[model samples]
Every structure is written in structure tokens, then in C-alpha cells.
Target chain A: MPPPAKIRIDLNSAVPAYRQIVDAVRVLLVEGALPPGSELPSVRRLAMDLGVHFNTVGEAYRELAAEGWLDLRHGRGATVIARGSPAARPEQLQEFRTRLRSLVAQMRSEGVAPARIAAELRSLTESLKP
Target chain B: MNSALFLSLLVVAFTGAFMLLVPHFSSPRYLFAVTVPAGFRASEPGRAAIRRYHWWVVRAIAASAVIVATMAQSWPDLAVVLAMLPAIAGVASFLRERSKLQGYAAPPPGVREADLAPDGDHLPRWIALALVPLALPLAAAAYLRAHWSEIPERFPVHWGAAGEPNRWAGKTPAAVYGPLLSGAGMMLFLLLLGLAIFYGSRRAPQRTAILKILVACVYFLGFIFTGVGLMPVVRVPIAAFLVATFLFAAAVIAWGYKIVTDPAQPVEATLDQYWYLGSIYCNPQDPAIFVQKRIGFGYTINFGNRMSWLLLGSFLAGMLGLVRVAR
Candidate 1:
């Protein structure tokens, strides 16, 4: 596993605030900076840390949650859920299955073959498991 | 009921409908057409500045809703009500920001326009795409309607203040509507979710049918039972079901519009590629890059769509129940 990513906010960059947040979180997840089961800073705290509003952080968290990266509870704040984690119940599994199918379709359209895609997916799944 | 009651009901229903609709109608382009656009061509720096300002406005509006919700003496429904303004602002900001990013550089020398356009006869395909998700919800609705007698009857009612400070506040009697109306609302919600899924599947078409079916089944389970098995735990599933449905619906609408209006570019093309020098979707990417660019974030229209339906369902059920009780 990698170290947690250093969260950076580029005030001068042209990227939108939400995208910046998304990018930063993505970097952390990709880099293993935020390990599976790591608790993320509260949206309020992160917003204050980044000098952005709570909604910016919330939106970022919401996006992440939608993508299966973060687990969002009403007041518990966001927590990193490793990709392909086993935390999903039946319904959540269905959601993941749906997302995976979409990703597969997308990758296929990109000409990724089944064998190569399957291998890469297996590796990804291994990385996500506890 | 008296004319006054009828009028109040009509106003409330319309208010709910308008609240549900504001996002769809006052979308970014529509709002920008009313406000900015012409101002964008002045300078690149000016455009960037406008984009930043748009984000700030979105934040401010969302914050205002949070404040109002804090002060309001309504039910938990106020949060859903408050959420509408910011959600709309967020969408508007997305469009405005995309517009600001127009025309930094020209396209590559020999990029064929034909490669950009996916194919002809896309309308029927698109409509089919939209309808795919509808099947699950319709099935769920039909099942619930047929088994309406199996639905449990218990108010599980509580009278208290509900909102930011209190869970239930300023409450009247548990305004009961009949099981039939509640069932009907579930069906309506399923219908909306189907529409949303159909729209969403256009952008991401993996297991579109199965996902809809799964979502519908989960929701159907929540709607049919009388909170019997879970007791206090029931609300959690119910809330999740509603939230998921709403987010799913919104995703469908947003993505569906993208599919119908624009030439079907491959997924990887950024908004900058498709645009006509900074109009709505000018940016372009090839099919390969587009398909490969899944960073795990696509809009889920489930949250708002479900809430709107839940409230509508709850209200209808309550009204019908009130009539039955009165009769």
C-alpha cells in the first residue's frame, strides 16, 4: 500500500473547485495515501482546511460516494472504502455490479480485450480486498 | 372538502411539483441564456473570473438553504426542500464553468468530422435506451398493486418537531392516506426512476436493465411491508431506497439530454472538444479516450428523484387514508 496523498488546492489553476476536490481525492485513492477504512476528514473540516465551502467538500464526497470510493453517513463523515471492497450488502453489490458493467462496456468500446481487462480487474479487485 | 381546502391542496401539490421541476427547467444553459453568454466573449481572463464567481454563488445559495433549514419549523422534508436551490445552482455552475473553458486552442489539423458523429438513426436507439430502466419499476409497481392486500396497516406514527433541530416538529395528526394511494406513489416513483435510469443508461450502458430491476425490487420491499420486520430499522432502508432512486433519476435526465441533442461522441472527449468555440459541448475526444475515462464519477439522479416521489407518495397515502378514516 502507498502513503496517503498530500491534499493540494491550486488557487491559480483553471480547474473547477469540485473537480479539484475530485482530483485530489482520486490521487489519494490511487496512491494509497488514504488506505482502505481510513476515515476522511469531516466535510466541514476539509472545507475549512481547503478554504472552500462545506458544499464543495460535500459535493466532492458525494461524487466519491457515488463512485464507491467513500462511505457517507449522515453525521459520521466520509470514510475511504477500498475499490472492490466487501463492505457492500446485496443492494450495494447490485449497484457495484451495475457500475462495473458500465465500466466494462466503456473499456470494450476502447478496444480493451476481455482477457487483458479481466487480468487488470482481478488485480484491482485484489488491491481492494481487506 | 371545502373550496379553501381544495385550493390549499392544489397550491401545495403545485408547489411540490414546481420544487421538483425547477432543476429541469432552470438548467444551466437556460439560466445562462437568460443571464450571461454574450458577456463571455470579452476575454479569457474575464471568462475564468465568471466561472469562479459562479462557484461562489452556488456555495452561497446552498449555504442559505442550510440556514433556512436551521430556522424552519417544518418536518424533515425541509432539508429536501432546502436542497433544491443548491442542487440547481450546482448544475448551473457546471454548465457555466464548461462554457468558460471554451477555445484555448484549435483542434488538430486533420480531425475528420465524421469520426465525431457516431451514426444516423440514433433517435429510436436513444428512446429505447431511455425506456430500458422503466421495465423494472413498472414490474415492481405492478407487483405491489396486485398484492396491495398484503400491505400491512400501521401508522407507526409519531408527533413531534422534525427538521435540523428536532426530528419531528410542528406536527398535526399523522395525516393518513390509504394504502392504495401509497402504493400508487410507489408506482409513480418507480416510473420516475425508470425514466431516470433510461436516461442514465445512455451514458453508461452496463447492466442497465438488471440495476433497475434490483433497485426496484429493493424499493418494492420497503414500500410493501408495514415496517414490521425492521421496526425502527425500517426507516433506514426506506430512506436509502428513496435517496438511491432520486439520484438515479437525476443522472438519467442529465445524461439523456447529452445523448439526444449532441452527436454521440466517444466517452473520452471532454466538453471542450465538442463545443463550437465555447458554446455548450464543443470540446471533443475520440471514442477510445472517451470510453477509457471512467474516474468513478457520473451523476446519480437517485437522491432527488426518490425524495420527491417519497414525499409525493407519503402525502397521497396520507390524504387517501384521511378520507377513508373520515368516511
Candidate 2:
């Protein structure tokens, strides 16, 4: 059997741990590595494994539940759910465009050519496809 | 030679050998409890440190052996103190080596990884086997009750190395059943401790391995204490119990050695700064109550965690209660 899906977080990173957890799980979910109906470790177990406070994993799980990607029950652990793809709101689309432009600008400032940036974006998008 | 003197020297020899082998019992990534790069243990400085440590330990053991042999007959009680010389020297040498390797210490790994799959929450089915030893004490109690008249009015409760009685207890329920009760309490404690380690510690094969060892220990305690309780009715040699204890300890150490030397065993990533004296782990931020020890094969309590303090308090209270009942 293949190895179980794993998530990695850098404790020394400036980014908050909860945000890192949320983003890593979101990428795995998008890539279908974590399929619908898959169970997540209990908050305490994950927190201990990650060497973080319990509240950090709980916050990340709650965020995913709010995004409709997970179902959180009282005693049962978090579970991935089949979420309906809602039509992107005009404001949400605009926000994504703005964030994308800002990221591209930062990469360009670091001496990345437009062609390289576009190729990197294409590679990531291809990986996201189910 | 006096048997007591011989036993004391034997203990000193065993302790020295165990201490000399301590460095090899940890993961290769660690040297003297400091995290180092892979293959660093074979490096020149590492080789020098190990050589120096062995030199000090060997000298200490020789000295301890001489002291124990000389003092064992005249000061039998003091021989026990002399037997600790090698272990004390080992610790002092270990700390010295650890400080020397601080310059070469690898930066602690910042990234932590975990499987998203839910696992290790449930206790193993074999854990129920720990309960099997509980029956030994009960059976001993029933046997004792059935032949209450056969028990002497006063019988030896404590014995010397020569299999002679040193202490006696009267014929009372407390005296007759105390050892059996204490044995049951110990088994129960081991069971609860195994459960705690399973649920509170990070999931790893080492955790399960340690739990199995604890189960073995419970069985050992069960049989030994039951035999002691039946001493008034049975004439089993005291040397038999001593030999059994030594054999059981050696088996446990061998099993631990196997786990330690296994390259595939994953070591817990912990900051060296959080470890006090290279043994006492106190990481306040880490949610784990028990983390794998860098110096040994099993887990140690994270003294910084509040839950650990609570557990320690409960253990002490339980021990005090056990002592009171055994008395």
C-alpha cells in the first residue's frame, strides 16, 4: 500500500502555524490526495505530532470546516467532505486577481522572467488537476 | 568469599558494563545527547569523545570494584554506596563530552511532519494480556486463605542473600495478603501507565514496544510478589527470586538494545535547549506529555507539560498508598 498522506509545517516560519496547516491541507484536498470521506487525526494527536498547541490544529480544522471542505463532529475527528463548487463571486474573483498580480510582481522583482513565472504557474495548475 | 561481597562486586561489574554501553544505546544522530549530522559518530572528534568516556568509565569501574571488594565484608551497607561510583562517573563524563560537542551541535530541525490518517488512538489487543497477571495474586490469596492454619504465627517476610530470614511478620490478614495486594496494585499501575503512554505520547512503534515491556514487567512483578507472599508456606530459595530479577532485567535491556540499534526507528525531533542535563526533557510548547529520549530507547516525561506534573503527583500518591498498605 502507498504511504499515508502527510502534512509538513515549519515551526520557525514567520507564518502562523494554523495558516500553514490550513494551506497545506487545502493543497492536498485540491490535488485529491485527501479524498472525500477521509478522516483526519484528532486535534490533540495532530497537535502532539506537530509539537504545537491543541488550539492551533483546532483553529485550522475549524477554518476548513467553515470553507465546506471538512465536517467536524463533537467526538468524531474531522473528515473531508464533498463540497459543491459555488460560482465565484465577482468580488472574490477580483480579490484572487489582485493577489495573483501581487505574487507575480514579487517574483519579478526577485529577477524571475515573465516566461519562467508563467511556466511555474502552469506547472502548479497542472498538478492541481484531478 | 562472602556471598554478600560477591553479589556487591557482581552488581558493580554489571553497572559498569551497562554504563559503558550507554552511548551505543542512543540513535546515531545523537552523540552525548546533542543532535549531530548523520555519520558524525564515526568522525574523529566523536571517536575521541567515546574513547575518553570509555577511559574514564573503565577507571571508575575498576576503582569501584576494588572499593566494593575491600568494604563489602567490613561495611556491607557501605558497599552499596561504593557500587554507585561507576554510574556517577559515567554521568560526569557524559556531561563533559556533551559540553565539548556543543560547537558541533546541528541546528534543531524546524519542520515537523505527521500523517493525516487517523491512527494509534486505539490500544493494542495484546495490552489486555497485562490483566492476565492479576489472576496470579488472586490465586495466591485464595490458596493462603484455604490453608490459613498452616501459616506460622510469625514468619519471615524479609530474607538475606544466604536465604535466611531477616524480618518477620505476624499471622494477620494485612501481613498475609499485603504482598499479594501490593502485587495487584503494581500490575494495575503498569496497566494504567501503559494506557497513558499510548494515549498521551506521539504515535510511534517505540511506544508500542515499551508497552509490551511494561506488560512483561507486570507479569514479573506478579510472580515474584506472589512467591514472596507464600514464603511462610513455601520454602523457595531467596536466591531464586534474585536470579529471576537479574534475568528479567537483562532480557529487558537486550530488547531495548535491539530497538535502539534499529536504524529504521524514528527518533523524536526535539530541541536540545529544552532538555535539561541531557535527560530531563522540559519543552513547554510541545503538547506531547511523553517524548522519545535521545539518550535511551524509551520515552521520558516532558516535565514542562502541566499534565506531566499531574501524572507525577498521582504516581507519588499511589506509591505512598501502596507503601502504607504493604506495611
Count of residue pairs whose backbone atoms collide, per candidate: 48, 0
Off by over 4 Å in 1: A1-130, B1-58, B73-83, B104-177, B184-204, B207-327
The interface RMSD values of the models, given in order, are 19.5, 0.6
Which residue pairs in candidate 2 have backbone atoms (N, alpha carbon, C) closer than 3 angstroms, thus clashing? Answer: none
Docking class of 1: incorrect
Q: How well is each residue in A1-130 modelled by candidate 2, as lDDT tens digits? A: 7689999999889999999999999999999999999999999999999999999999999999999999999989999999887899999999999999999999999999999999999999999976
Question: Best candidate per DockQ, number?
Answer: 2
Question: On residues B1-327, what C-alpha lDDT tens digit does candidate 1 reach at each position?
Answer: 332223223333333333333323322222222222323335575455455645555564546445544534333344435535544554456456546444333232221111101122122233333334334434444554555455345434332223012222111122223233344445445545444433322233332432444354445534443332222212433334334545655565445444322323333223223333123231111211111111111222222233335545665676666456422
The CA lDDT at A63 in model 1 is: 95
Native-interface RMSD of candidate 2: 0.6
Query: In model 2, how large is the Cα lDDT of residue A62?
Result: 99
Candidate 2 chain B lowest-lDDT run of ten: B158-167
RMSD, candidate 2, Å = 1.8
